[model samples]
Target: MGHDLDVLAARFGRHYPRWLLALLIISTMTMVLSSTSINVALPAIMQDFAIGRPLAQWLVTGVLAAMTSGLLLSSWAQARFGPRATLLTSFGLFLVTSLVAPFVTSIWALIAIRIVQGLCAGIAQPLSMVLIFRTYPGEGRGMALGLFGLGAMMAPALGPTLAGFLVDHFGWRAVFWLPAPVCILSLVGGALLLPTLRSLTPPRLDVPGFILLNLALFGILAALAEAQRFGWLHDATLLTGAVGLLGLAAFLWRCTHHSAPLLPLRLWRNASFRHTSWVSMVLGVSLFGVTYLVPLYVQTVEGYSASDAGLLLLPTGLVLGVAVFAGGWLSDKLAARWLLVGGLGLLTLSTAGQALMGTGASFWAICAWASLGRLGIGGIMPGVSTAAVQDLPAEELAPATGTISFMRQLGGALGINLLTFFIEWRHVAEGASAAGDAQAFVQSFWLLTALFALALWPAWLLRSKR
Candidate 1:
């Protein structure tokens, strides 16, 4: 099978790298689409399952937690099984799980399937990065990554609108089945075109490190998830958060001492790696937090239907998709630092605009500001990611990519929790009036704006030149 794939890739390699990139982008977009599209469906799911906001949120958090855990295993999987085999296996699992998800009657069952789907997505995500880096030449690597980011970025951008339509017209189950055709195409492409690239020295799996990382991530997420319900200073929240912090400290210590840590401590030795990781975390916060909050706000506070809420982001997503490609192309020729700074600035402005948005604000005005923020995100993503590992050796690239991706997912999970906590806290304090809900959302947006501003300091630390 490996030999056959190699020959086939060579045959296709004759046409141009674009075809291979198309396959990868489609595969990756399916996973990303799966991730973001569900946000719009959460309310519908809540209605169907007769659950409250907190339980409904697990649909998002569970997938993120599962994806984060799956990311830790990706480098090892690629090293042990080789890229083509890993891609084929993961893609197949994703397709099967997504197909099965819509049929599950129980909410717990659906969440379980979502986690499995997230695991498959988590494996594919980092591998896609490695594949792009390997397939494209060094000079053109940014352009390749940019194209890949375009697909990944666009999925979230457009996914909600599509999901809203499906959920509104066909029911929430339709959202689960939306990615099937794309996944099928991606599966076929992976079998034929994905290269059989394997690490010569596969790293040992650090089972203890994996466990500690999950304990930390899951604990922190759970703490944040329940903080609003239990009170921020409640013993339960404090204990869970403390345990998570200790687990994180232990995980870091283990990485420093272990011969083959799950996440190599040495990756941080590079200045670029350190800065880019911080930027990626902030990017994740903005990206995922906004995606989660916008639809909920529009539907609940502003009285828009799910479809209308989803459509509000359509222009922003389209702008982001285009900007990502341009950002990638320019990163190859310009200083990444400028791009980072500029992108963060736009993100800050856009987020702040959202924070200041009045209940009576025009829909187009909201779209315009959000599109500006998405544009900024588009500029920062490709440049920051490319810069993160651009200086590392080939052997270190896989783990570096995995680490970066992990941080982003971690940030996303935490960001959603943080925003939710703030929203709930404010809503309770301000009283449950419709105006109060709007106020809570506005306050949460302010918090996000502050995060984007804080990210700029690290973005400035990024190396100016490639």
Candidate 2:
């Protein structure tokens, strides 16, 4: 097999790595598109299903929660089954879920399918990142991830616009149908491009740790979702929140005691990885929070059609694609902390700008502000991703990637839930009129701005001496 691969490598030469990276970018982008595109369609789905905002949000939260738990599985999966088999299995599952999702009548059924899809995506994301990091030379990894980030970030940036159009013309179900073709293409590409890399002695999956982690995530997410309806101090909310916090404490303890832990907590021993992980979580909150907030804001508050809401972010996506590539390239030459600080600064400005947006704001004005924030993200993604695992030893890379990805997804799941409840709480407080709607969204954007600003402290600490 080694000899055959050597011959194949010689035949393909330098192009082989590029082809593999391309396949990874495409497949991962499709996974992201399947999830992010749903944001614009949520209102439509809510109407069709006769659900409220809390339940409607499960469509998005379900994916993030399952995906967060799934991140821990990738290290074990890739080691046990090899990258080719693991990725193919993930792609296959995603393809099946994508095809079946549109036909479901119940929102719960659709949410269930989304959870499966998110799990498949969860398994694929870190694997792809590890493969990309391994494929490039040390000097070139920043550029390689930048290129990857271009596709990954672009999916969320553009996905909403396309989904909006589909929702307006065909219906919300059309959003699910969109990713199927891409999934099929990705399956074919993965079979041809991904290499078979497996550990001889793969770590065992920590069943107790996995269960505890999910319970923690589910309890927290459920508490947030329920908070808007039952009040934050209510017994149901308090109970769920307590369960989540306790589960988290137990999961952390298990990571240290378990022989084969799901996510090795020891990765945090590296100071750089710790700082970078903090920034990654903050980045996730910004990434998913804005995607969720803006679409709903424009449609519900400003009375923009779904298509118009989607269109608002199209320019932002394009900017992110270009900026991500540039940021990646720069990361290889410059200090990552410099880039992170600068990026966070830009994000702070962008979010602060967004807080001032209202119903009277022009379409182009909204796009400009959103695009500014994405440009900042392009800068952050490469620097943080590269810095997180660049210092870790070879054996620890897979778990490190899984851990960082887990943090990001965890932040996103909880961020969306919290933001959902915050908006609901504030909207009612403001009297629930057009004025109230605008104020609620403005306040939400301000909260995001503050989060971004708070992250700057950690971003500055990312390899400061370097």
Structural similarity to truth (TM-score) of each candidate: 0.90, 0.91
Q: Could you tell me which residue pairs clash in candidate 1?
A: none
Error of 1 at 60 (Å): 1.6
Question: Per-residue error at 253 for model 1, in Å?
Answer: 1.7
| lDDT tens digits, residue span 1-466, model 2 | 5423344467569787788788898889889877789999999999999987888889898898998988888878988988888999999989888888888899889989999998998889888888886677586776677677678888887889899999999999989988889889988887777777778898778888999998899888888887887888999999999999999999989989988787788999998899889888888887887888889988888788889999998888889888887887788788889888988898999989988765678888888998899889888987887788867899987677767878888888888888888888888999987799789889999998888899988877766544
Question: Model 1 over residues 17-63: C-alpha lDDT tens digits?
Answer: 67778888888888877887888888788888997666667678778
In angstroms, the error of model 2 at 172 is: 0.1
The stretch of ten residues in a row with the least summed lDDT in candidate 1 is 1-10
lDDT, model 2: 0.85
lDDT of each: 0.82, 0.85
Stretches of model 1 off by over 4 angstroms after superposition: 1-5, 10-13, 16-19, 133-144, 198-201, 232-243, 269-272, 332-334, 386-398, 461-466
Compared with the true structure, model 1 gives a TM-score of 0.90
Top model number, TM-score: 2
